[model samples]
Target: MAKIAYILLCHKDPEAVIEQAERLTATGDCMAIHFDGRASASAFRKIRTALTDNPNVTFAKRRVKCGWGEWSLVRATLNTLQAAVEDFPRATHFYMLSGDCMAIKTADYARSFLDQQDKDFIESFDFFDSNWIKTGMKEDRLIYRHFFNERTQKRRFYAAYGAQKRLGLTRKIPADLQVQIGSQWWCLRRRTVEAILDMTRKRRDVMRFFASTWIPDETFFQTLVRHLIREEEIECRTLTFLMFSDYGMPVVFHNDHYDLLLSQDFLFARKISPDAKSLKTRLGRLYAAHDVTFQISNEGRNLFQFLSERGRTGQRFAPRFWETESSLGRERELLIVASKKWHVAKRLLAAIGAQTDIPTIEYLFDEENTPLPDLGGIQRTLEKRTRHRRALMRMLFDYYETDRLVVCMDPAALDLMHDFFSDRSHTRLLRIDCDFSDSYLIGHARRVGLAGERAPQATLEQLLPTIRNDIANEVDQIRGAGFSHHWAVQERASEEENARAISNFLDLSHETALDIVRAPHLFAD
Candidate 1:
């Protein structure tokens, strides 16, 4: 007899929201929805009119204009929760969800599952100790006053934040309250919900403190629930299945993810695209189905394992952790070709391809044509490649099927060459120094459509010497680190001398090296 009350906070897609509301209330559970004030009034009215006839549904009287990383989100949730509590007195539990969330399991199953558990399900951890706040002000989130909307008014937000830092202004938390952080989605028992509402009513100072706190929606309920409940009575995890990309954004579900969604034990999956009609329709039918005996499958776990392995290694054939001594002992030798000139590197790689069956890749980190898997957008893809460069390179090494592989390094990759080559005793380094001339810059500019920029010409003139010095410094540091073998071919070396250098570097016969150096189509701009 554990009745559930669903509090939905929606900002867009009225049709989708209506469908979700109908599906949830079809089984007799009560729901309260709060539409953002900033959203189109017509969209909100459309949703309300569709669900008006349903006795189990109610709309919040108060609507707030919610902003990302703002207090209004928490306010919207509170408004909806208050409405649901007032309308549905018999409800024993309250679950908060966003407009994008959809029930993945049968309502009977969710009710039955909750009936067997007395603990509240939420993701809560110490705010300072946890690494959950990726790429942001961590402890500063609580200490500083964030008055501006971080999403819309980024400049003002940072300006205020900077001013506060300069003046050393910080707010102190109440000694009674322990600061905690968690995801905004959570399910709470009736008593817990009542306690939270009661605390909000009585503790005006605590609420005021959180009103200006950054991303308070994630921390508000999380901190309060921990303060109110016994440690043993809480399960520190969300019932909603959520996944984030490397860029710290939620992964949107699509039509093809139906099987993946079904395998998860969580009652709900979120951030589903409104355009995914097929996925939404199938999940709606499943949610409204009579079957209560569905068992969770292992496919979800298996999929996570596959993704985790791919994340640890690359698309290569080599094992995870190719840099480790144990993995290197069992793996093939790796040759890294470094140069300040892209054309020279390409020539060497082409030569290697012609002479030996050794797999060769040119410019592994080339932003235009990277060897890494496409990560949706160029900015996100570039950030992932650069941030996890070493891990990605190891993955690439594991991916190739060969006794020996040669990878020509991009000029942009020179900054990381020293650290990359350090302590990799199994890897070999071949450095080719070529003069960085104005003609090379001009050719590159023409190729990439930057030929008209006189600024680039002057910039290159200034940067040429520095680029050469950096290359020379990295070469010395890498050689000092002592890899399996290190060879350098100076800038003015003749084709024959360069061929001899390659032969020495690869331990190949002079005739074979000559054939590689003299291969057709060796020159490229």
Candidate 2:
């Protein structure tokens, strides 16, 4: 049987967009189509590169601007379907996705589900059921699906869908049948897709009618499906699973409210930062053999980090074409961050250069720029000491820029990294944890005689036993008035200490002070 065609609609953030495409293609059954509408050539290049080495990826030549309430999306969607139909004629389903949204299922599972005779996956939300009269409709929108082509035929239909409890229209369609305000992103079976496309081709009036509806995306397919069901035309149900919310809001520093939302049973959610740990931890529970993986684009930074980390350093830098406020050129920043440094402050500069340029500033400790101290064995210690601080730096920049960063190295930084970036409404101070990883920055030592080739790993293994002891001794020193600055480790010593640790972490990390907001539970434990 022909497999489901994975149709990814990527607009920006070419790296993460195509990275997700790569992930989805790994399933081996999905074919990916990439379209660039007013996106940078670099963005297009990334999509092109992603699909180049792959056999299943196809690039669409038609470029259309996707505006809210415009016909562009419809045209694009139809064009992609036509291409998929031509390329993979036997394909049975079309899975549409946004560039930023990750794949939540393997192709095998997707094929299995799509192969099922009685299933159609669409997001469902109630509409006009309450306070419908206020909208001024005279008939149910569902009833008008047939006569939707005729303007005069819509009055009674509006009354049915628009009338509230006061209008004697108390009838409740099956929540499934009730106006299923579906997501623009969805998986449509062949029959459903073909029906919609056929109607588009056969009826100009249908298109014109939808062109005038509010939120045309939700109305277009919905009208057809409602009409189909009413006429006993199809077997499909709207899924009421998963609600979405932004997770990298700056206020997240004040409180990790997004973390709470990740704990719920949501089949899918979008716009999560790759580095968000608390949210990752909460959402990781829902991960299965089939689930989409996503990484947010750092407003406009981190592409170099992604390239370098993915070992694409030799790849040519293609500048994306766009109007920018930066006179030096929008592409200059990419070149700046990708260069190697020869000094300590320059090293710091190298890091800053890698950061997205949204109000980003560099803070250095040198006054005269003297030779930096290599404090015997202290450089290694300091790198460990700076983990949380560095994480905070990344979190701050990512939040301010509203872009995602592709971490270059060290999984040691994952959890702390994520916690620092989880979306919040206000910035809050949070303490950095130095003990998240057992390994030290022995890179310099490893290269020199001070540490052996296996020394770093050996030190990591030996350091495990000392972690608690060393941190405890440090805590004791602080508690006894030897030091007053607030400090806390990831591992808490007691109930009070744990709470205090959490409080301190929040206090030092949050850039602002505000009540934490909560999101619906989407990830199941």
Candidate 3:
């Protein structure tokens, strides 16, 4: 009884677009409608043949000719939704997506999530005042009126001229107007859709004002939604995991990665270039997201296990896929701590097994009382036994020389293990707890004392003489540069004292970990 609708604008890449459409249709809760570039009949024919059998996918009968930087596309989308709402009156929600968008959440879970929110989940993109949207029109109008007396490039000029001709605007430009400038991909409740359309009718003047803007898509709905939600404070985070890019990461949430479903939404993707060797074996790889680093063979098993787990959880604990630093062979001695039932662990271990000489150990933590197999007991028992511990450590040391460990665990485990290694030497630890807020993992590691034959705290006086002057110079440079966080390099002999001193200083200053990275010179490089 639940329904959602997708509207895809087809410019090119018909196969890729239809393939993604068919995949979404397979989920059985939604329908997909495609709007090809009306001029490209060949593209439409090809797409139609490919999707002919998909009962859920329907090609729009009327052609919509969209111009660059114009409102036509937005208008087409609105018209399509208006028709869909009338046709499927029982459908409670609708989502507008592009050909590039693939679903990352399954139909049921996505629907359930929308049902719970009971409000629109359109991202507030600051559309009205987005520089990208304003730059085109303002720059065009200036060029038209000879504001600067220099002839610039004519792309936006043409766009603005066309918009002006299409929709007459005789008045001055409006400032302090903020619109939502984001991707058209949005999930909206039925009432929200009606509200937007009804408000559009009431605010004809505002709508007419935006129709002359080069990027009317940014102006129209964003302005309307902001006005409507102004009093209610309606907020919506993006449904897709694209925001993960803010952290210098290509991956999304570990649990909610909808593999095939993710291909529908276009965050920005390039079609595979023509230089590839063969299409059959290589095209899938070519179509994969550029930010994704793993190849198909490497990702297949992981994807399979991930999907299986989602099926088991009824897709509740949906996680995204993340590649370890080892995926690129830049690091060694990778360790993963995960829930015993986490399906991705199997594929992770498989990848580890494929390595030639590397030793990869996966520590499956029993987070929800799922008793691990015999391997768990064996590994834990080995950790306690001095002979086993020393022998394994010696082998690991000999093989890796300098042990680089990657620990994947929750906060409590990170805290406990960080405390355990506070006094031990000969081990280097890094924690991957991207799911949690705060950088406490790094803080905990910094507070811990290092172990080894050479005590950093004991020999600081001996080595301070070697780098003490450099430390002062660096500190002066950092402070002079207006750096709240500074990094300084010193001899390893002063590691423990240095960490303690820096930790205390940061605690007193109430500065974030990032605020102190500029002071790395405070520790040995």
Candidate 4:
């Protein structure tokens, strides 16, 4: 029988903490809790009074005023762990948890699972080699001293950090310790816990070194455990299911995530919302059930896939459910008709507009020719438009009241083209390969100021092959991503032939092709 001891570091929500503590110790297991000294005295008294009846529950005698990303957090954890060890002599395993965490599975199941495994389940990895720390100083976190609380006193923190950098004042880790970093949550066997407590008693120098290190709670125990255990004795993964946002904040679980929480194989989950009463009740029932079987669901994976796609392509505006063959639904379709030659793209847009009732605009993304309002000056307008290109496109669609509109774009706007190419569901692209005649190249070179040793025509002639190859490679990549595209070479095609090709590519009726042919202004330069 493997009895477990839980050490909970709580700072808020006394009622919720009481509920979690009662549930975890419902059986004969023991628990040690440390309430932050900074929290209100009333809240602490409530939690203590509620759990005083339970003989297995104990409170840390040395509570600290914990601050985020500060040494106080590690001190609180140490106090709580020490309390659990002295109180629960029969406990075979120790699990570190937070006030916001809850058991998603039965306590019996967790105890049984731990009984079968001899390994310590923790997320420990080499700090210097891993990319886990997304923002802030990586190696500097260990090399430099962090005396100020980064969360509350950000200005002082950065000032001190800058001074340290300028002065080159640094510290070195003890020769025996290899620094490791990981999440603060972990589950350790009794022997691992004993060894860690023993080290803290004997190793004052290492403790002093870590006291001034930034966010030592994340690295203190993680690095020490690695020094004490063999690589084979540790599992470099957390049993708690935790996720962080792109901004490096924890994602809180709510009522809507009930199914996602139940489906995960992890025994516990953290950072759950205190307001999620319904989710708490359901998970509490699941934890109390003895015969319920856990099954993995695809809901979690589908969410991650959707987020990944959104990261690659900017956020999606149109509802995916709006996809249909009806005219109203087709209004969500946007076509970017582009060509190397501006006139060719204009002609294609006209041909497409003649075939369909969708509105058409010429050079909508061209910096010089865009229909958008000018922002003070040319350079300023260009900067604003480029920075908020996605927002501008959404504004364009909203202003037109339809995404079915076609817009002519110069191939030079590759950034905008890449966006449309990435979205295959609601967008389509057509690239026209027209002849880049010497006469046109000469005019283009002079307009853009191609000043070099060689003549304008000669300079363009030298660059033409590379430009063509780059366009071809871009088109190949778009095709590889399963984007709907049509590549047409209009260098030798007649006006009527070109109109008919555009009509067929856009899935327009043959009668509309004749209508485009009759409109001679569309082909005029």
Worst 10 residues of 4 by lDDT: 321-330
lDDT of 1 by residue, 1-525 (tens): 789899998776688788888889998898899988967688888998899899999989899987667898898898899999999999999999877688888888888989999989988999888887766578888889998865344446889999999999998997899988989889999999999999999999899899999989889999999999999999999999888655344555778778888778799998675457899889889877886565577476466557656765565343333233323222346688877577777777766755554557667666446333233232246565556665455444433323366777754454555545553435677887665565775555556564455555576566556555665676666566655577776667667896788898776878888786676644434
Off by over 4 Å in 3: 49-55, 125-180, 199-204, 229-233, 243-525
Over 116-223, each residue of candidate 3 has an lDDT whose tens digit, in order, gives: 666666666653344533222344432122111011213334455566556763455445345555545566667777888786677666666666555456446655
Candidate that scores best on lDDT: 1
Q: In terms of lDDT, which candidate is stronger, 2 or 3? A: 3
lDDT, candidate 2, 450-491, per-residue tens: 457765576756555555465445434334532222343232
State model 4's lDDT: 0.71
Clashes of 1: 8
What are the per-model numbers of colliding residue pairs?
8, 52, 42, 0
Candidate number that wins on TM-score, 1 or 3: 1
| Cα error, candidate 1, residue 114 (Å) | 0.4
Give candidates' CA RMSD values in order.
Answer: 18.3, 23.5, 21.9, 20.2
Deviation (Å) of 477 in candidate 4:
58
| Residue 487's lDDT in candidate 4 | 42
Q: Give candidate 1's whole-model lDDT.
A: 0.74
Superposed Cα deviation of residue 161, candidate 3 (Å): 7.0
